[model samples]
Target: MNWRLIGACTLAFASVQFSPALGQTDIQSQRVQFARGASSATVKGTIKGYAIRDYVVGARAGQTMTVKLTTPNTANYFNVTPAGSDTAIFVGSTSGNSFRGTLPVSGDYTIRVYLMRSAARRNETANYALAIGVTGRPAAVAPKPSVDAVVPGTQFHAVTSIPCKAAPGQPTRQCKAGVIRSPGGEATVRITLPGGSERNIYFNNGNASSSDARTPKFSVTRDGDTSIVTVGAGERYEIPDMLVTGG
Candidate 1:
């Protein structure tokens, strides 16, 4: 008479034992390779349920590494962990969607993409694209000559300095200074003030210019043999020769 109730209880016990929530599944990581002299790589995938994906890449120290993540789901993020360490080197949620900085150690790094804990429990799906770029170490640079000690026969070129009017109600004034040089060799521009402060900017392409939002505002532009520089308010500058020679 109790056979039907006993059978129901046995079926319920078997279902609990074979349930997916009560067991763990091992997920394997994928390896990523970069081409020679290549600075960037991208990985794309979809994440569903409690599954996670990982990518491993090798990098060198002193290299500038940058990462960017694009995803439709806000609850999906990634983690970057250095070799032999459990602590994440970079976490997407805490550090934002992009990371840019110099790497300290040379080794394989892991990039893990997964959903947030709540999202994982709900078995949500997320599609994402991850991009990484590594800029190799810069070439070895020779030290510059001392500022006080001048090299013999090194002539100083005269530059035209134009006073720049400050904005209305502004206290300090600025200037647009110009220097003429021969169109060859690497161009080095040095700005020296009366208080012994100096700022050096180098142009490898021989003729180039750059400007940023930093203040005191400054910019450099090279056209043929003439180099024009814009300096901040009330600062003096020294424009040396286009050719910089030293050990």
Candidate 2:
């Protein structure tokens, strides 16, 4: 790492301390925490070449948060950096399966993960898992309808009502990924935009993915004091707009 990058990392860790979401208890409490003294935030991941790095401290506009890999590996030599504002903070290089990057954009960013081949383990493939946190408390939960049964307007500030009998046979029902309920499940919802950029929203916390496979991708391009989401699956009672109040 260069002097400028090293200085940034030092300043970031030295100046800010992250906060864990309170009352947001989940199942993966054991896999989280640094050493008890670091903080009580708990985010868990069970993927290769990656894991939830750390909960950033004092995450705000114009701030840079660095996430580190838990272990180092040689098979995977590097990482991916997002484009545009997303690229401002990113996975720069390979440091023993660990990395140093900043959070440039806010409202749920991602670390594009990949793997490299190893000389000894010639067929080595990576299946990484990761998590996120901030220096400040997680955003408060907004009371949203568990299931909306109505059509909504383009600017969806109001919750659309999903009638119990909206579907033809009334045989299907929707499912929700409660923030504090499950902390180990994974959801891979891909949403493509007009700009040719796709957003891969992963919703895990145990309740994220269901056996029925009814989950949605949540993303915001701009304009919002609130976090809005929409489910992608065609389940009758599927709800994608979940509240992120807990870790």
Candidate 3:
């Protein structure tokens, strides 16, 4: 069961000093008039009342934190200041009910949420539950791999490993190339693929391990009856079926 454990107090927002001391009591409406946003803590959704956390799970101090927000139809203000620092890192109006900022220092931060006016009902009550959290900045997202085309006439296939960063933009390959035979079982080599992916595998047109990202780097494409392979990008040809031909 996936459950969101709240680390701090569940008490109303107004109770916490410098947290989100604003007008309009914490209403029960849709739990803080939900608006969508992303922060170190959670994903896409309107957070009624929450805290800023790390963008990356279990992110430690010294990591940049990304904070985002959306307010839909209300005027509001939010700011974050690193612990022990007197100046707020980012402060501005919700441009079109949306806001975003990053925090540098690590520690307990004071995220103040201020409303334009005060209503008899306090801010904590559910007109909207503004959620804040701290998280590590997002790492580079890897590109999605395309579906591999199967060999036309047979279920069996072949592939060759390509280096990620080959000699100054050149792919990584065995310092010495040729019929690399494994002493007992299979021949394996350390090779990098097109996007700086490294893998060591006994490649010869075999099974699923062909594309195992960690290693076993091999080119695999099934475009009709022709299966091609080039270790140095058309410089060397890895015997398509070394097991059979021993080429």
Question: Best by lDDT, which number?
Answer: 1
Model 3 CA lDDT for position 105:
23
Each candidate: what lDDT?
Answer: 0.49, 0.28, 0.32
Evaluated against the true structure, the overall lDDT of model 1 is: 0.49
Ranking by lDDT: 1, 3, 2
Stretches of candidate 3 exceeding 4 Å from the true structure: 1-61, 94-102, 117-126, 131-133, 137-247
* Candidate 2 stretches greater than 4 Å from native: 1-60, 77-88, 92-102, 117-121, 125-133, 136-247
Tens-place lDDT digits, model 3, residues 1-247: 1112121322211112133333333422211111345433423322233322211222222234444544442544555544433444445342333343332222355544444443212332223334545434321211111122212221111223222333344543532111122222233233333453332323333311232132223464432332334323332223233321133
**TM, every model:** 0.46, 0.26, 0.28
lDDT of 2 by residue, 13-57 (tens): 121111112122221213233444443233334323222222223
Better of 1 and 2 by TM-score: 1
- Residues 1-247 of candidate 1: C-alpha lDDT, one tens digit per residue: 1111222122211211111111133345998887786779998889886677888877753356788889998878877765434446467766677877544334677787777667767878889899988775521121121222221212112222222333333443333222112123333333332343333334334433321113446656554444455546433222322322211
lDDT of 3 at 142: 11
Ranking by TM-score: 1, 3, 2
RMSD of 1: 24.0
Candidate 1 Cα errors over 4 Å, as ranges: 1-26, 138-247
Please give the lDDT score for candidate 3.
0.32
Better of 1 and 3 by lDDT: 1
